[model samples]
Target: MSQSTAAGDAVQAMMRAVVVTRPGGLGALEIKEVPVPVRERGWVRIRVKAFGVNESEVTTRKGESDPEVTYPRVPGIEGVGVVDEADEDSGLRPGQQVATMMGGMGRTYDGAYAQYVSVPAAQVIPFETGLPWDVVGALPEMFQTAYGSLTTGLDLRAGQTLLIRGGTSTVGLSAATLAKDLGATVLSTTRSPDRTGELRDAGVDHPLTDNGTVADQVRELMPDGVDAALELVGCSVLADTLRTVRRHGTVCFTGALAGQWSINDFTPFMIPVGVRLTSYAGEAADLPADVFARQLEAVAEGRLRVPVAKVHHGLEQVQDAQDDVESGTAPGKHVVVLDD
Candidate 1:
């Protein structure tokens, strides 16, 4: 066994983790005493301080994720912590603060739903911040998806008008703030008018209520159509979202919040002429360390907001966090914090 240290404290042989023996309800999540993960030559062991509950994890729990997930798995797609161990050449040192997400963290291997998790060194992003663990834990996956969708998927530029198809989702809110920071005009959608204030607080310039369709409402606000659109509600409304973009504008498919992943009777003709379509499913590397650091600073300075809906303490609350996420009662990121 390889012994490691976190912030000068000796790493324990056994750690508490949330283990899912099989896909089912929230009851499937079991807190167990498990052996601490050991890092290989190209891996780093993180002493997980906090993690965020996401819909992907919810799907994984319900046997709805990709087939790569196996039984006896720890489910967490994103986490923030201090390094407990690392290879000398891994460009990471013991005690370094870091954040990790995607790149098969939770599905193919044991993930961040533990006191410690070992992951590929290449997928780890080192960052420094004075913000609380709950705030930082909510960032990795949400920001990665939003940033990738806006920059890589859409190539959204300053002054461009952008529409977020699912404005109340965590990623949608993150996109609103990021687009605002880039000097873009944002028009977001919500199925309920009651949630428009959430979009406005996230920097959305206009919040349109979605009643199965909103292209006409979007067109009314921007006669020439928006310069870009982000589709999070899935394929059911994708065509309508595409209609809200200009002829040469782009639409980035990044989420399936409405639980619709595919479209029946789909045809290439569904896309408008000269309107490009793209998608973003990125990993930790998709988000740069400097950008993460800057955003954390922004949060600290009150220039940016992390819409954390709830924070649960310790591994015991993992079930509650997942339940809140599955219920969709919480409108923003749900986080779990582990205290020593």
Candidate 2:
């Protein structure tokens, strides 16, 4: 890590950042000192402490543009930091701790891969959890995504049934936690045979492995079929997910690791069955302040358990982190620690 220069040193204006020169693999990333972003009116500058890696952001760095990607960018989507500077109008102040995130962070702007970043003041969410930076870093994207899909996208009711694909993943697990807390019956899928029991321990009542046909397994569990399906694995099992859902049921597609498959059987079949296929992309960047505060409270109080599989050192090691996330070695969240 580069040391900060003396007070009033113009050199301190620059910060060290990890840059993706090209998108082949981990070897393509490099660390270099660059100009620190200056705070502008209505924006806040944060000194990044830790950042979380998401599969979509990794795919974005590798040149996926579902959210649109630009080259030579930083590679972290969610992170925690202390405010370096704040815009007065936003009611945020310097030295305040906060978390920030949105769609394709590193791909869109100079992102959390750098020591410093400037984002709209409104986009920053304040937390008083005092949780380790890694866990805090992992929360925003997964939490917001889960919260939005459950409450907004699917309009999940208290007694509805939810089936989550990739149940072992961070998003999958987080959604399970939220649904359970909301009084829903949670059924989930795990590719790993060993984790099926673990999912039950984590609040998912019915867990299935990829080997079994999802539709049949779910039917055996809920003969009436599920009210909703959270599609994190994408096309490979989308058809099966669609089949397991009840008439007028909804399936929200949030991730696409299993290859984007066409819903060929959905044309006439979906209408007759009353199944709804909804592809949820982005979320409201700014969560309701009270809900976000409660989320942080859940993390601190242990109601929300965020599992971190690995934490690498700084921006330079981000490629390795990305590799771990992509290879499925990360059992939970993969993070990049920017500070000691």
Candidate 3:
């Protein structure tokens, strides 16, 4: 515990943070005391209370991600916290509640792995919430991806039929939940037969078990194909997902859990005519502040729920938490809680 300050001239404070000395194993997770970030014009510093562990972080930790991911970096992509310092023009005051995520976080720059993070004011979304820090921390990326993929990527609508290609995944389950909330008949799939119940509990109406040819299985239920689909498994299953939708229907490619990043033998004819194909990838700045704020409001009002699969206190368990998620044992979201 060291005393440090933000902006250097006025206040002083200190904070704890985790650093990845290099991309490797759990040994890379190093916790230490660091200076509280200094706020700049058009930027704000947050006192992080909690953060979420994402698979993207896992890839980065293993050195298998982008070459731009420099090591000895603080690795956190999303977090919930209070404003430690902000200029009035930032539209946030000290003590204001906000969440920080994506826009170059944990990759192009130092991110939320610290007790305090200074980020672009646009990337810090202000909101009102009484939810626990773990829950708030876990919601942004998963639900925002869920909401964006459907609302923007696929342009999903009420009374539509949606098939989540990899339903048991966190994002898949989140898509199912949001689609159901939008009045769609949600159908989801799982590679594990044992997890069908989990998908159903998450609001998936028709839970189908499939290893390959998931589209064939879907065809059995929806002979004319669904109204829309979200291909979560990536290229290996994308063609299958595309076929599961009717002519002129929509399909959004959002995830690549199957590890196939590119499509071989891909041709224009392979995609159905008039069948819209779209993808969603965004930074924190790309995510509308109003969208993030609305989700927080919905969760506080009990109109929505962001299920955290597990919550580990302190930065010490970050490695364990990431390993657990990599092992595919986490049921939903894994959150890391920090003391206020």
Residue lDDT tens for model 1, 130-230: 88898999999999899989999999999999999999999999999999988999999999999999999999999999999999999999999999999
CA shift of 209, model 1, Å: 0.3
Error of 1 at 133 (Å): 0.9
Error of 1 at 76 (Å): 0.2
lDDT by residue (tens digit), candidate 3, 217-316: 7788889889999988899878778888988889999889888878988897888777888898765655577877767777777666566789989898
Instruction: Go through the candidates in order and give each one's C-alpha lDDT.
Output: 0.92, 0.79, 0.83
Q: Please provide, for model 2 over 1-340, each residue's C-alpha lDDT reduced to its tens digit, 9 standing for 90 to 100.
A: 1235567444435678888776756666788888887777887889899888888666766676454677777776777889888867777777888888884466677778788888877678876766778778877788888888877668899999999988888888889988988899999998889888768866898888977368998999999899999988877677778888899889888877676746555555543268887867664363666788887788788786676788787676787888888898658888888775
RMSD of 3: 2.8
Best by lDDT: 1
* Residue pairs clashing, model 3: 3-13, 4-12, 4-13, 4-14, 5-12, 5-13, 103-284
Worst 10 residues of 1 by lDDT: 1-10
lDDT, residue 274, candidate 1? 97
